[model samples]
Target: MFLVESKGGAIACMLFSLLFLGTWPAVLAFLERRGRLPQHTYLDYSITNLLAAVIIALTLGQMGDDKPGMPNFITQLYQDNWPSVLFAMVGGVVLSIGNLSTQYAWALVGLSVVEVVSASITVVIGTTLNYFLDDKINKAYILFPGVACFLIAVILGSLVHSSNASDNKKKLSHLSSGYEDKVVYISLLFLSWNKGASKDPENGKEVKVPAQFGTAEYLIELEDKRSIKVFDRSIWLGLAITFFSGICFSLFSPAFNLATNDQFHLLKKGVPHLVVYTAFFYFSVCCFVVAIVLNITFLYHPILNLPKSSIKAYIADSKGRGWALLAGLLCGFGNGLQFMGGQAAGYAAADAVQALPLVSTFWAVLLFGEYRKSSRRTYILLVSMLLMFVVAVAFLERRGRLPQHTYLDYSITNLLAAVIIALTLGQMGDAKPGMPNFLTQLHQDNWPCVLFAMVGGVVLSIGNLSTQYAWALVGLSVVEVVGSSITVVIGTTLNYFLDDKINKADNLFPGVACFLIAVILGSLVHSSNASDNKKKLSYLSSGFEDKAGKIAFDSNKGASVDPEKGRQTKEVAQFGTAEYLIELENKRSIKVLDKGIWLGLTITFFSGICFSMFSPAFNLATNDQFHLLQKGIPHLMVYTAFFYFSACCFVVAIVLNIIFLYYPILNLPKSSFKAYLADSEGRGWALLAGFLCGFGNGLQFMGGQAAGYAAADAVQALPLVSTFWAILLFGEYRKSSRRTYVLLVSMLLMFIVAVGILMASSGHRK
Candidate 1:
């Protein structure tokens, strides 16, 4: 009986400790993100004291009649399961990468209602994915609440500070300063994905909260009257609500555990069925509780009220919008796994110790590293989809005859979750003070950070390559730990080494050293690559040995030849010992394994081009619009401002499409005569992409040339419409599910409606 009672409690408490431990790092970061946790001090003492309290309570519960009965779980001294142990540790490491909150706030809610509207878009994405995958869902989710969430995210993303009649439009302060209204939305919008983690522990655990930071913002203001601060009552309220909700969700986890058990398993036929009693009463209450909170915290939303003219003006000035969007997506990817996984685990634990995982965002964040967070959403979605697919695989381990619709169900769930996770991760990346543009330019100003970042990226690449190799030989944990170690080392290096003084001279050493040290590092990287190739060879040999009579793998040494009856064995190892050693056994780890390295290079190169082009355009538009009091036509400033705003959105999209098409470094054009057409296969398509932009630009330039400044939009519209059509015609986007496609079409319809209102009002001429 004692052993039975203690079975799940220990796991539950460990999870609770994570959330409890997590809040400290967060608050510590909230206070001074740069500094390490103070050691051997009062803060440390407090943490220790809290940890003791929880352990004591758990200890007492586990003890038998004044003595602990060896605490039900036999803490194995890593006895027989070394591989599983390694995997678990790696899982913990990957989960620890998430950590951006401040920057995400601005992307969510700008100064204007339009930006507030844009911020609301994530919710649309989140809810859309949820609607499809969630077993218990409603119609209102799609038509009513779903549309509302998207409109809000968009309005928020688009909202920007407008210049007053007598002044130039100030760049809205990116960081919070004397911005109450916007900050309110920032905190709230941030809460949309990052509701943080659970504040309290579960039934079997004790939580140590930090002095209940309730309304601390107000208290701080009262304590220091002279201080004009970003944290105030509203911010405090938002924080309190966020943390409190975490507590509520924590309570839901154990209940869900019971529900999961009940859902999957069949109980015995007895007088009082164990499952009937346990599930019926508890599940109903849990559902009701979840429903209430979901509606109040997530579903219930503010009404949108965009001025018809402002919406039109936004359409006109959609120039700088691409960065904002890409930023939003990256931020979403970073956030989704941390926030959604946190919230889900909180509810899934059903008031047990497992609920503690939510406290520490790092655990979840690390799994979706900052770099991965910043990559293209499609890749992020693909990674997420792969993970969900793994989960579906685990689901297959259930002790029963599988259901008929198992594959379909798993596929849909994986796709939906992947979409939601991507959107969330993208949001987190866009929210941060991203890798400074100066760093990747290989410039003097940010060279230190950039240099270290690139080195870190290299380390990451090596680790990923190693991980793929390791996974083939071992399991998932190999990649997880090695990859985690690389990130930690790089992030720490960046934090400590990167400063203002790094210059061309400092960087020159590395550039020169790289050449001098090429053999050593190259030996390391290339050697690993070669060894992996060798291992891949040997893996094939082993396969050939085991299936000696059954199959043949003679490929004439790297020559592609299809043998009879084994046509689909392109992934087969060749007829050699080296071939059998490195054949791809763990396909999942290696599938998108090179994503980190590839994206690092892509982001580095593509961002430079995108920024260089867009910056000049943005500057031109800003100068043309704001300086128009004396320059062009009388009301040109007003007309130009709106055009530039709309350009922001469109330009970002165009840049993304361009980047997607030109991702592989080899795909870039060759400059000289011989090289020019040498890269034709790559350049030909690039030319078409460029031509699409050229045609769009030509129409835009011509419209501005022919029509008076105010009416030039008719010409600009040609590019946007064409671009939209091009996206449809090109098979660039994934084949979306019918439901998702429909939802997107509906969004398009709403955008058209919004565009119509804007175009009609454009004729009014402000």
Candidate 2:
């Protein structure tokens, strides 16, 4: 009654299979993030994957002597069919490209969507290919339908939870920023049309247009076409890449199986383990070679070869080196396990393992913070999708072993069940009236919050843009460090230097130091290796809230309408606003440094210095020695300053959106201006967000006026306010891994200490 043949064994294998495969994809995500940072490239990924395969091959190569008839794994590989090895290598090349594209998909779409799509594709293709090609396990009836059902579920799930466009803004924003220098060729006819409109005479009765019968209407039509093309291209590119990657994933197992099958004489019929290890080795070699060629070609033919300095910088980047090595090991080992598992447990066990999208979806939600607070329809869709995967595994494993029922009968039954479930879920999830769209949530009440946010946006726009420009001039890490330090030190000093002479608390500097240290630690946590208790860990967090201070915190819960929950008023009680949380998450990650970082740092340092001046500038406009704004506006000083700032933010947002419409950085779709204006689903929320943001900004200014800017900013480090809300209201940290909890607690404690220091430093009250 081994686990492979027994029901219990199958279950155990499925769970273990998730560990062997589910978590490894996340490492690739980390590598992709490195691609976005300084001194990293696909070459690094290639090198790392090769190294991991080598390590595993070498390790497994040591073990084949256990079998009496076999030579070592390496010897067997050379002794096997040369064509088989070559084909395996070719398969590896396809896989490597696919793997790279998988990361790209993750970056472009998200973990959950890509996981479902790719896993579904792999199951269908791999199951069918291996079943017919390999003698390892044979069950066409159960396998085909199960895989089909899985595919259907994936489609339904995708439709249910369409890409959260707003959620992806941060990741996609960089594309626009990176491509800021790239130019788009536009038709001159539109320009001519605009010019004619501008030059219309006072009589305005007759402005002759071109003989082609062009007019304002024609311009509008042409503009719409251009916007739709850009928008559609971005969407199509992402979908195409995702599809290609899925097909590539499907080929890996079949290729490896073909390489090692003794019947095919693809490789030597050595010890089973030795064969598996050899297959991996051949695959890695191919991956490495292909990666090198592709990357080199990219640098040379497509884009001019990067300067030697950039290449050197990439090579010299030691920071991501460790992560890359770790990723390679995980990936190589994971593949090896799949091969071994296929050999040991049979096709049922292997197919069950292939159904890993469930595990991936769980991790995507918990670790990456996706799908939180999604609509009920999304929840149902996700559940339905998971159930379909379960059905797929159930039938896929019973393939050749059915005693009473025919394969066709089981397949039809399973297909029907999947269709019924998917339909039920889809019908259940119809977009109800009150769905959270985020674009149309504006209300009269939200205006104040929107106003507040716009004010904050205005107050911070110059500093923010300067920060972005500085990153291009220098690099991100340097700018962050310099900006953070200056914002703390200079802003605090200016607040203290104010004419009111506010009492200074003693913990100001210490608090700032502690928070900065914490920020560094939190960055490390994201990049840190997981603890050894990896198998026992569920990828999902337990969605439970601590009730200790629930009653006390409940009072602060604003009667805000829940976007995901529909138009119903829901309590969103928390100290931190959404803006604060977004900003906090955005600023958390820290990258490894390179030579380019120095220039970026220098620019960032100057920018940071300028950033320090903004808070003081607001302070001055409100109530200063010059009273340049305060005296004139008197009671409306705060409002006037905020009004100006909001206007700035509005202008910048509009200009940026307009620019993106023509030249999309992230390759996102561009809608016509009419479409944008017509879409009013979440305007209330937008205004509310803006208003709340403004309040936060005004409060910052007021706090700086009362305490030193250093003290006020130090208090900003107490991000736990938002964390608590994310937990209680959003159930964010439920049942997370111990390491995750440790990271969370560490971040929380650091922020607390920083806050304590800031609080202690704010000596006397106003």
Candidate 3:
């Protein structure tokens, strides 16, 4: 049977397993949150989960020439390996139960906390057992410390959940009477008081309203829609189930370890230990069987007071079946990879993936909105929990390999990561010795091409600078849509001609037209949203003026108020509704003028023009289609051009930013170089962002050189990604008019179609 004998191959399997396993939980949770019945989801998931194992066994387990001792999957099925098979089955049974329990726990304790508790328990208990089972193949000193980190994460996770639950309870208690009647009015309040009340001017008495999601309204909606009713449920039940699931999770890995290695020598002396594939097949088979029986039974006799369902009901439920099946596939493949890695590097080391709460927390925040506007204490604990998992994974991963590396080894790690990803996706092949050839060409003569590369960098820097102001003026969604559409329309056309029509014009020009349509729709959406914001601001301003006048009249009549109460009212009033918009405006570096829309559109147009020119200039530098080079001088290579381009971009950014620091414009506060250096907030994040951008550009240019720059301009669909973030991160378009929402979605759809068409237009350079 095929085997992963090398440490590197095993580590690769482990890393992929971590990603896949970490993501499946989020998918399942997503379905549950959307009100899909757990029984139906689980039943659907079981089919694909078992199918994954069968596919793996048929492919990887039958690929290599089978030896006498290491029989292939089919051969092993008929052999006397029942003892090991039973052990594998037991592991699968426990895992199925553990997963089933966690589904309910997610609704109770929250996705992020449930994952943290369960994964920590798995690592702490499972790793300890696997270390002894695997004969201490993994380093105890490193592995034990990583386990300790998981334990800390468990404590912090519990604390975060407890604190957040308290915050929710407090918010619910303070909810105003008759809030249900005024639901529409209450919804308009932006950041409102979570723990107290504001004065009602008419009655001269305190009144309260819901601000964020953990309110009575939200809970009632969830109870009405969700299969697992959390209404009036005790948090202790969820915590108890979480602990039980963790214990179940802890035993499965060690059971699988014994099944593969026969650590207890349960088999006969002559019987070969089951291979990873055969053992995994038996494990998944039992898992599937257990899941089927339990989920089917639950359909007839549901738990947690969930609504009764039957086989007919499950068969009829097709709303989220595709997502459930996908989750199963992801989990099955993830488990297979984990086992393969464990067989090579010891099951104890493979337990490192139990730190997957890091991935779970990311999805919980991004997809589920788990921690939006959470308390400071909860955020702190959550951050600490994630950091501990990171350290734990690092220690466990380090334990799997022998330590030996030079400076060059450390330096090339990032480059190697990029190359590995490209190779995996079939975007790259065997490397060529192009660096020396480019160096030789540089010595001969390429001064004019170097100038072309530098000019591209200069324009790119200006474009980047202009975007900061444009975002404040035109908004993130509109700016990205307009800018990216302009890039594709102008840049793609330019590259098509420069590359000698290598790209199919028929397909390319249609994509450009789609982008043009998107631009128009985007402008309409922006104008509609602006009008909505103006109405909100006008109402807010008039209301505040009326309240101030009332307070002054009361003061003149010798009325008095508590100083603390006045301060509390001021604090609460600063959030929610038009106050949110005012706060955002206050925080921005560039102040928006009354005529800023026109100015913003001008800057956006200029930025798009600059962005469109950079790629064509780089194309000229690499391809030299304009023949701006001396005789016998070769054109600049992709890497050489990128180097000069990024260098000039960096230099220009540094000079311009320093100038802006001392002499700021557009009503931005002025600061000196010393002040910039002393500012420490978000410095690490800024540096990381710069590195990612540079790496992305480098990859884009490399791919462009290989294929054609016109097709490479497909990356101009930046609005698709930016719009997703704008909706999630900044709450853009939330509670906007229906017409605005339609325009927004239509603009995104056009961009998607445009991107696909542009990619389809790619043609071979030769």
Candidate 4:
């Protein structure tokens, strides 16, 4: 609490930074529905490293080094207007906390009124307190208007809530109910199936009700296939908390700015500008890293526990205006604002007093309507929050506390923000409303995935720290606005392509419009001068081809052989040569594939081959390259490009996994991670695929990490390895198709490319 004051709302501003940062966390929640798979869980989120950084920065910003250093933004804000800034920031934090506290009321009450009630209550109390605390009575109009706004918010929330309830009740008459609400529809089905068993007299006839047009048998026999998949409230609560925390996180930019600006102002002058900027920059990096990673894991929490394939809705319902689009806009602008503010000012302030549940809860209630009885509470909360936020703006303005208008000058930037926000909104709407995103798929029942997810969580913590810097550098809205926009726009486009049905819709008004827009956007992006510059930058492309030719030649005939002249072809190769072998020219020169690509792939491929062949190649190449044999570098280095690729795969895998995770949560049967193993139907031979995958990964890990360059050079003997493995192991050849053969040839070409890049970089005497 004291730190909040010291930080001058930077911590509060983090609410926004953390908000957009929550996409991954939401995804994690969707994942829990899928069973059998070890959940993608990360422990890093529990730790708030950026929050710690904020505390430190806030405290340090306040006290200064005391000797003589200070950041100018802080000094500027503090020296010119300490009182205005302090009071305004304090007001923001308090108001934001008020908004954050009753955030869930949107679901409990109604969107319109939840904010009103919360805000009215808060403002009323705040006004009363202001009479004594600030030595000024609140303006009657502002105070009364807040109350009225709260009332209006309440009325709207109630109306919308009740209307929704009626619709739900009617719908519920035909659907399955969970533990909370019991429905007798399914049992009736069994009863109606029986003919003339009880009520019918000696004839195969159906019983009937007086008012019912259909027979009693028909009433019970209605073939309703609707069911509801429910989530554990405990899990939901956790997800909600994370969501709330994200809203609170959004305010960090403005809040911190208010806190640190004053401190920087008061400082005398020993602090270097670099130190000031660096403090915020490092803070941002840490915050962002944490936020990014935690976001991923948090999203997995729900789907990991859900019944498979339950999130999909069996619907004849009309599609309404996309709410996800709104969320994306919020995320993008929110992030962009933080970066802008933090960059411009020495501090970033965050406070989410009015942002809670607004975007997300809106979707939860309207789209799914799962909260049940809280319809009233949700209304109240929404009403109060709205009123409070509105009053907050007015009150803030009345106090004349605007951060000396920094956003107006740049039209291009603002336009960029708008388009990004719009594009993102559609994307967010298309997201799988369930949890346990693709990243969690990378996690197996074993420890590798667990370890990676855990490490990922740590990275998330660090990223959250980066957000603080984003705020200090840019502004709160900038980060969310820009980042969310990017995510949403891309996601929306992908969603179009991801679903065939959705793509079909592209022929309509908004759909066609979206497609054309995308095309134009693509053109803008591609037609830019940068595209040409990118082509000109390809001077090394052809050189790689020639080098590939050489490697292919050596591997084909053996001229690239070692000069030791001792025994016959020794398997023990040297490190330099191993690295060199990968780069040698071949039948297919390095011209197209290039060295870097081959090196990455080679490690990705037969890394295990390298491990076993390590000692064999030891004599062929230089000791300097295979130096790992003496030490433990072998074990450590192997995980490099291999695992990073896993992270990349998670990005796509989450998409498929979400489908698997969602269908189960929606109570759809046959939804499972095993589905990921299959092609179209559930026909993928798991044992075989697993072995192939495992073999592929193990080789990469052991060979890349453990083998010296010389030992790795042993891979130059692909022909020998291929021949032996091909002939000896029936398993390897059993699945070999024409495609596989083609791919192998490509790999051969790539190997040569790798050698050439190395050679070119080496500057040969020739």
Candidate 5:
């Protein structure tokens, strides 16, 4: 059987599983919203769900040469492993029930809320159990912290839902009272035939109804289009079911863990532990059995006063059969991948994927428009909840304990260390023994230079913002290379002239030529990678088109294709290999698809220009090359200039980010200042990032003042760090064509050579 031995491979599996699992719920929800019977949908889903397991058994389960300890899937089928098999079956049963409960809960609670709550509960209970079962492979400090984050996210999610519901209630009340005086007309149309009207009678004439939130009219429209009758249900009922589902979900993973590992020594001595494939196959079979029995029972005797259905009715219902089938395939494969990953990594770490609410919230916003026009408080809670989930997942993904104390503790310790070093090791000799420090000097003179420093900060802020978008558009490696190269070539040249050409001209000019060459190679790399991605997208589109044709044929014979069906078809086409790219685009606050590559390049160029100016501006602030200040005024020290620079940078960044929250460019969703203030997640990390940037910039300026400023531009080699992370963490260049890889390597090499040459030209300032 195939095995994922490497940590990276296991991580890849878990991430893919997370995407697939998160997506299937949205599919099922969509079908339900389109009025497809849950009974029929589940039955259709069950068939493909079992089929997916069988497909895995035949393919990955039997691929490698069989060994004694780890038998192939088919061989294990005949072995005497009923004890482990029972455990697997039990896990399947629990998972099936959890899925069934969620179908109803989704209608009562919002999709995002339900997902967050259930996932949080699952992580809290299931991850702990799995940690013990896996012999505590996961670090308790990191794992528990992640679990705590999820718990906080759960509370925030609940508050967000409560606030949003209150908003809807108020909207409906106002809407009802506003139209109370209008001439009323209630038409008794056939419930099955009429699609419902969006008009209100006024003065014996039909008037178009305004957009609604939660009026009786809106409820009726929802009831007409939904399979489950949830208009009269209380939110309490949903929460109760959600809790139950979470409990069930929490147990299933542990049961599966026992089945595969036999960690408790439940089976007899001779019976080998069940492999992942055998366990997964049995698990799926039992899950399919449970789903079939329950859904068939529900068909004959419906709940929530839903119309009764029969086996015959279910067979005849083809309205959303394709989607239901697709959801099953997604869920089945998702579960298999999760199990495979759990077997390689500890199941406790694999539980990180329970942060699926992050993905669900993306779909909820993009597809269902769940939080559109929500209250400021609701938006704030929603963003905070998502941020907490992200942090929690990051913590879970870490493989080991932190080296020292907590991040905050280490940061504080470092600060104290720096202060001690500065007081002792950084003392000046007798020549400047009585001189005041830079901070005191700031108040005495060179106040006008602070303006230049603040201007530098403004330019840096703009460049930083632009680079963020550029990273998403052009890959990180290219963006870093091009942006850094621009800074070195332009900013370094300006600094050399500003410093009265103290640096060696021959070496500096050669370094500038190297940077220009690196820039060209960076552009070429981006173009090649873009072409590769386009080809991949084209292949996915072609395959999906064929599937769409079959769907159209089925629709023609079974049911008339409506606009909703058309939209679903279009969305489904974006699934498969390109799903990650599509999901990333949807999840981002900024929307940039219409302009694509050119827009990214434009932003990068603009950022490069901004970046190119900041250094020169700072140089002028410290050296007073333009003599803008009075002759008697002392030139600003590095520390004084940096203090003004960072202060202005902070102000500009806050103002712009806040503005973007409300009046965002690139078609981003609207936000408010309240939401900005409400975001508690990652705030500490954000402060840390700002602190590091300020400290680093101050040090760079200090070094440049002693040596030639042009040599200090070598810090622009930051692309080296960024590229390493882009490849290792984000998987930026995976599966790219040979040509793209070649250009990428060439660009990096040229950039390194250029940085080294620039540093070699360093000259001592008099």
Candidate 6:
């Protein structure tokens, strides 16, 4: 009978299997992403997978077996039976075909459908094949039931995936709707129908409408407008391919098993080789050869999605190459672990690895924004699937003598480790003799300013969010220049009006003008320097591929085209490839910013106004109207204000993050418990930054309490502090030309002039 041999072996197999199952999703996702990018094609997938197989083989070949006296992999493989090697080669060929088919299917059907089909079928087929291939088993009942349960789990997980994908699509649709006004929406739909002949909604009859018509026609068009959803043929074909791809994938393990099975004597006797390593070597060789041959054929009849120059262009992208390389490494490691587990245990153990749909499902829901707005039914199904996997894995790996360990055990341990590390680091940092620690400061009775600061913090956070959204829609340089100017002017105006202690022209206008001028000049210099860099890069680079496989120039910023749309552009290619590439990149960048320019600018202006009120709000609360609570020690007001501000920032950040997790109105990243734990590792640095910011806020408020809001804020016009630090400490401007240097220096000079003007314009105390 086939046995686990020992508890250690079973545990090792389980760990390796999980590793194998978990990694495939990540690796494949990376490959698919690279292939789908503007310049990449299916050939990238072929190359990376081949490379991964080769790397795995070589690495595995170098390692000795568990037995001390066993020969190294090179000797073992060389001595292994030829038929065994042949079986492995067949397995590799099957694997290559299945993987290619799966990729094609993914492109055709969406990610949701493809993942579900392949995963469910592969789990069932692979497990069945492996079980039948090997007769040895200590507990057949436990194994079979476990496989069945795991299959159910896979199906349930697919349902969850489908539900999540549907939700995300709906969310995206809502976002698009939000972007369009009623007029724009009606106009776009009118134009769309007119682009091609469509049936009239009123009579269900064919009609050809003109693009620009009279008001009566526009009214008629709006009345006839109804929702129409067109289904693509490719989606059905993709589903079909994906279904068969799973079956093909299932054959790979059985073939490998036949090659490596010593107990069954499927191969020639007396072959003294490590089964996993030897099989991998042969499989890798076959995979490498097959991928090259297929890729060559693909060159003549390229895939539907890929551009003609995709092969060359993909190779030119350095960032893409890095992703490809990392993916290959991960895939290799994962595959190797799977084989090791299968060889050590049995097909049942390997099949149990299919329980990885649980991991994939978890990540999809938690990280990839799956099921955020899914129905209660979706969650129930997902939980049920998880339970099934739990029961399956538990039964499959159960041995009466062994201690049962769950994922919770590992999670708790990891969490404890993180907490302990954070506390230890915090204690060590607290040992430094400079400032009062965060806890001590927080606990001290500084209530009034604290309340004021907290309220101000919320306003600042909202403004920051608006500014971020503005940046994405508007160009960076404009937002920075305009936002800074608005902040200075509005803050100064508010202070002057509210305090009634400042002269309008002398205290606010001239200072605002100087600050605005400085901001404008500084922004211009920065943008110009960046433009110059782009120019230099365009001129010098001959469009050769770099070591990382990216084109030497910035394709996103300059002249790169979406290969699919511009595939036939021999004219552009004839032009210096460098010029053509830079042009394409420039067009892409322009299109993105231009689309939402107006809305983004409007939001940015509002954000700037909101940001300006922050200091004034605190000033009013601590020193003016709400100063009844400030009767105690003056230092307490500053400290109390800071405490409240910090508390507000913390609370606001947490609440907003939680809200985004479900609705994602801003489409921001969702915060999760896992992420929180991960952030704990860097808690020491985070705490330090927070402490510095709080101390700075307290001091700023203290200055305001003494000097009035106008003067306190005017001093902040010293952008030169940041500029000097960036230059002197980080050597940021070392590569800039003399002209760039002059502009930067001039900007700094203006900042100094503005700060001096504003500080001099400080209002008198009431």
- Residue-by-residue lDDT tens digits, candidate 3, 366-423: 6677867667887888877776666666564321010111111221332333333333
lDDT of 5 by residue, 1-766 (tens): 8987765567557766877898898988888878988889888988999999999989999998988789999999998998899999999999999999988878777789889889988998999999999999888877998888888987887787778767655644543443222212122113312444344545564443533544445544555568775634556777888888889999999999999999878777777799999999999999999999999999999987789999999888999999999999999999999999899888998787786676677667656667777789988998788877776776643211111111222233224323432343233333143344554555665767788988998999788778767877797889999998998889999999998999988999999999999989988888887777666556445543343433333332323346755533323222223444444444444433344677788888889989999999898988888887775566776666766776677667666766666676665556665654444333333333343455566668878989978989999988997797577545687777899999999999999999999999999888
Could you report the Cα RMSD, in angstroms, for every candidate shown?
26.2, 26.1, 23.3, 27.2, 27.8, 29.6
Clashes of each: 106, 40, 3, 248, 0, 27
My TM-score estimates for the predictions, one after another, are 0.23, 0.41, 0.53, 0.28, 0.53, 0.44
Q: Which segments of candidate 5 are over 4 A away from where they belong? A: 175-220, 397-766
Off by over 4 Å in 6: 1-10, 13-17, 27-60, 63-70, 105-117, 150-235, 262-269, 304-306, 375-391, 397-766
Q: Write one digit per residue (lDDT tens) for candidate 6, span 52-124.
A: 6556556655654535424545666557477778888998898777766765654444344455556557766
By TM-score, highest first, what's the ranking? 3, 5, 6, 2, 4, 1
C-alpha local distance difference test of each model: 0.27, 0.51, 0.76, 0.32, 0.75, 0.54
Residue-level lDDT for 425 in candidate 2: 28
Write the residue-wise lDDT of candidate 2 on 20-78 in tens digits: 46766665565544343211446666676687677767775655353554456666654
Worst 10 residues of 6 by lDDT: 399-408
* Angstrom error at residue 746, model 4: 76
lDDT-sorted candidate list, best first? 3, 5, 6, 2, 4, 1
TM-score of 4: 0.28
Task: Quote the positional error of residue 514 for candidate 1 in Å.
Answer: 7.6
Best by lDDT: 3
lDDT of 4 by residue, 166-246 (tens): 434444455345423433654655544453345667785666532122232332333222111321123234334333433
After TM-score superposition, the amount by which residue 99's alpha carbon in candidate 1 deviates from its true location, in angstroms, is 22
Q: Point out where model 3 deviates above 4 Å.
A: 176-223, 397-766
Model 5 C-alpha lDDT versus the unseen true structure:
0.75
Task: Judge candidate 4 at residue 222 and give its lDDT.
Answer: 30
